[model samples]
Target: MPFKTEEMLLNVGPQHPSTHGVLHLEVTTDGELVTNAEPTIGYLHRCFEKYAETLTYQQIIPYTDRLDYLSSMNNNFGFVVAVEKLMGISVCERAERIRVIMAELNRIASHLMFIGSFSNDLGAMTPFLWCFRDREEILKIFEEVSGARLLYNYYRIGGLAADLTPGIEDRIHSFLNQFEAHMLELDDLFTRNAIVIARLKGVGMIPRETAIAYGLSGPMLRASGVDWDCRRDEPYSIYPSLRFEVPVGGEKLGALGDCYARYLVRRAEIDQSVSLVRQCLTDIPPGDVKEQVKRNVRPPVGEVYVRTENPRGEIGFYLRSDGSTKPSRVKVRAPSFCNMSVFNRISKDILVADMIAILGSVDIVLGEIDR
Candidate 1:
């Protein structure tokens, strides 16, 4: 006689460690294999869009910081750029370079967190520590520049809140010199480990078409061999002049668009970001960091949509101005929110253990998803 089988419905979390945040996954499984996965969000929703409409343009900067707390500087960059476009304000060259440097540094820090947490989710603890150890250096630099370690409301409508502090570039260069060697060490320790390879390789594959259909962005979209990056294609702020490679998942490591592929893409992006930072340091010009603008920013009656390449993906802000101090409408195109839409599609027919690997690879920030 054939063995009897039964399907079980499993609730992964509103509090589970593997879910990454306050996200609930209603996963249906047959023994160890997951047959279906439905991600239930909104536990952390703060009505971010509604709040933006009520606050003045400057006031909303701090709230954007809360959306993707890991990449707060990028969030600030996207919002300010949008408001600047609406107001027709021109940012100084020096401020543009400063914003790019800060945003890229935040990208590196955010990816480092992903690396650490993803490794922890896969059952290895050592890489997690190593990732955080390196990430701390970046965070310290942020603190020095912004005076806040986490939610930095450092970007203004026309430019930055302040210029880069003296000697900060030297500190950044020193960190970059050390970070490259440490990255190689991390690769040897975890990226090539047999256990990690077995868990990640050929698992949770998302095809290029599916990724595009779902509007996935950032590393998730690139890892699927899409070869699209808003920074490169869209050309926002100083990104037009910067030179860096957009890493994509190819057949070299366990087929394209797999969990392992995403991991490799993120690791490679860290290197590219390091290179971008060096270019910013070498070419950064001296000029007025902030443009002269009215204290109460009242953009002329119009609407504008601006997108920036954030650490997670493309962060866009749509603003409708009615010649008021406050925006008439504010809508944020959050990358985490869009990326999470593909979870149910990709998680189908994978092992429950593999589901964890897939979720880690997706790297959703619940704050942004639930917003």
Candidate 2:
């Protein structure tokens, strides 16, 4: 039968569990295959940027924590780096080391959710629970350091809110020793599993050139064989001093771009992050975690763009400041937003079942996308 004249428009979510946190997708489909998809955002918008412009530098860290609540440490780093640049203040040595450790730990936690949820999308239940088990250990580290698990307002403008408690390093070291085995086991279970490879290897393929053209950064870009990592390329916050490889897509079926490639890139990144954490612990200089600053922090009127290699991609914050106690404008170039832009392009040719899997592989958070 020939196709109908009018395509059916279906809404995937404002409330769908698969949409991942209040993201609404206006998906136009010709039966089982999506023809066009438009992401409808702002359903969970806290207006963090608008609020950021109104609040002082010190006050904005908590709001940043809400942008992508999964990896609040990255959000904290993004805002504070921008403010620190504006104020011309550098964080202390120990603060930078602890910040790196916490941020990378959070990255692993976010990736754990990605692996688990991606597996669940494909009807695999075991990997989901197995992944979360390890993630819980990472959460314990966060709670010990920040006194909060999810939205940790731990990283302040010029330093950490506080120093790590005694023996936290020992706990982290033990976790690292065990988490490595867990990650390897999980990888063996799913990364090389026949069913997952069949579903993902050739589906939702994104080319390297197109990924760059679309402004895709982070794992999504790297999965397409683009060797760009913000931590290595544009080093900030002691990352330049760290040793970690950028895991770009490798030769799989002589092609470097697909959902499978993205998964591989992220999986490789977990190992890299773990190694980085160990190095940070060894190299962290003894110093004050908190830097002294005046009561009212007024940076000279200017602007700065700071980017971090979040688990999602290049999470960026652009801040404009006037010589006031607060910012004039704050904009987030959220990776999830850019990563989601490819949905309409890629999902049009795939099976409906693959749509959820593909979307999950992109690892989006509606909070960051809409914000």
Q: Among these predicted structures, which one has the highest TM-score? A: 1
Among residues 3 or more apart in sequence or in different chains, the pairs in candidate 1 whose N, CA or C atoms overlap within 3 Å are none
Judge candidate 2 at residue 9 and give its lDDT.
83
The TM-scores, one per candidate, come to: 0.97, 0.96
Candidate models: Cα lDDT each? 0.90, 0.86
Instruction: State in Å the error of residue 65, model 1.
Output: 0.5
lDDT (Cα, tens digit) per residue for candidate 2, span 132-249: 9999998888998889989999988778898999999989999999999887888789988999998888888888788988888898999998888888888888998888988889
lDDT of the structure predicted as candidate 2? 0.86
lDDT of 1 by residue, 131-183 (tens): 99988999899999999999999998887888889999999999999999999
List the candidate 1 regions with Cα displacement exceeding 4 Å. 1-3, 252-254
lDDT of 2 at 135: 92
